[model samples]
Target: MRCLENRVPPPLLMVIIGLAMAPAITPQLPYAAPWQWLLCALLVLAGGVVVSLALRAFVQHKTTVNPLQPARATSLVSSGIFARSRNPMYLAMVCFLTAWAVLGGWQWQWLGPMLFAAYIQRFQIAPEERAMLQLFGRDYQEYTAAVPRWWRWRTK
Candidate 1:
């Protein structure tokens, strides 16, 4: 159980789940070519920016970005993309999935992002938060109190 917490990297899990959900995403709606491409491109660019900002913050702080090694983190980043979402890296992945779903015109593919979020929240973010609590104590507590796990635009 706990041993499986950080075993599978989130990106890998998302890919596996997305593939499994592919069949359901078929019979996709026909959408305007330009509009679909525009939406997909926007999502991918947003995701790239979000992920890059998160990675830059981690590098700046000299913290480990490896999800499998939260204990190796040397600092807690609560700025930049992190301020908007406690798990910006995960959010970036969700954004990419959203783009995929949209491009495929598969309403069922929308489930990929939702499922990814749920899985990360349960198995990845939860354990990482616990480790952060242990490592940073009050600072991490304050951060959790302030920043929502997914996005600040959403309710706590």
Candidate 2:
């Protein structure tokens, strides 16, 4: 299991998990209401926007976006979408998976996102955090303190 860390690309892992869970998504709803389709489209669009913002932030900061090379990052990005979620790209992947599950119309399909999150949290994110801390030290710690790894809503 340790050997798997940072090895498999997240998008590939997401597709693999989704396909592995397909058999359990059987007897999907016979019909999708127009609103359900609209919801799915919205979710995918949101995911795209998030990942795009994350990528643009990385490019703007001149940091390495390679998940396999977190230590190579030149800057710690903590503004814009990054200010909200430390791992917006991963969150976007979850959004994409959630949209698929919604369209599938089966409760079990939700496991795709759940499993992906768990795996990423343990395998990808943990190691990435270690690298960030090693590279950026207190600045990385401050950023983590200010932002959740995933999204959170505020009610103030």
Candidate 3:
């Protein structure tokens, strides 16, 4: 997170910039069906919003938001949506970013989200895991061992 904070652009900021660059980012001729486009947009926004809300609540109630310089955690949270994905936030971002790239209508914009994933993984996700492992030890390990890094079908 320290690396993410100091070396990388905020995810939100990068998303906004990519959106604003749509004129340049988009394909010159997007021939996709209007309904299909709408569906894609909705799916992305819905996924992003849902994940964002979950993360916000988790940060507020279960953990600290300042991953860069984390304040001590009050508890080890492994219930709720977290039981499914060890990185729901990342999953959500991927959905949102995919929709965003589709909105751009150009193959080039796909790299934006991919880069975001790479950055988050390397800078935030990896470091945060190290910290959590150190902080919670075996309990954290158990939780992560059960919940996958990304996809999950079981609700409970």
Best by lDDT: 2
Candidate 3 deviant stretches above 4 angstroms: 1-10, 16-23, 26-32, 56-62
Residue 25 error, candidate 3, Å: 3.7
Angstrom error of the Cα, residue 53, model 2: value is 0.5
Judging by lDDT, tell me the better candidate of 1 and 2.
2
Misplaced by over 4 Å in model 2 are 23-30, 154-156
Candidate 3 local lDDT, 1-156, one digit each (tens): 463442443456457646764765456326656765896779678777768766776776767655454326556667676777777776777777767676656677778678767777787677778778888899999988898877679775
TM-score of each model, paired residue for residue: 0.88, 0.91, 0.75
Per-residue accuracy of model 1 over 1-156 as CA lDDT, tens digit each: 687798889889878876776665544535437887799799999999999999999999989999988988899999888888899999989988887788676566778889888889888999999999999999999998899887887444
Candidates' lDDT values, in order?
0.85, 0.87, 0.69
* Weakest lDDT window of 10 consecutive positions for candidate 3: 1-10
- RMSD per candidate (Å) reads 2.8, 2.1, 3.4
lDDT of 2 by residue, 79-119 (tens): 88988899999999999888778877777788899999999
Please report the TM-score between candidate 2 and the true structure.
0.91
lDDT of 1: 0.85
lDDT of 1 at 56: 99
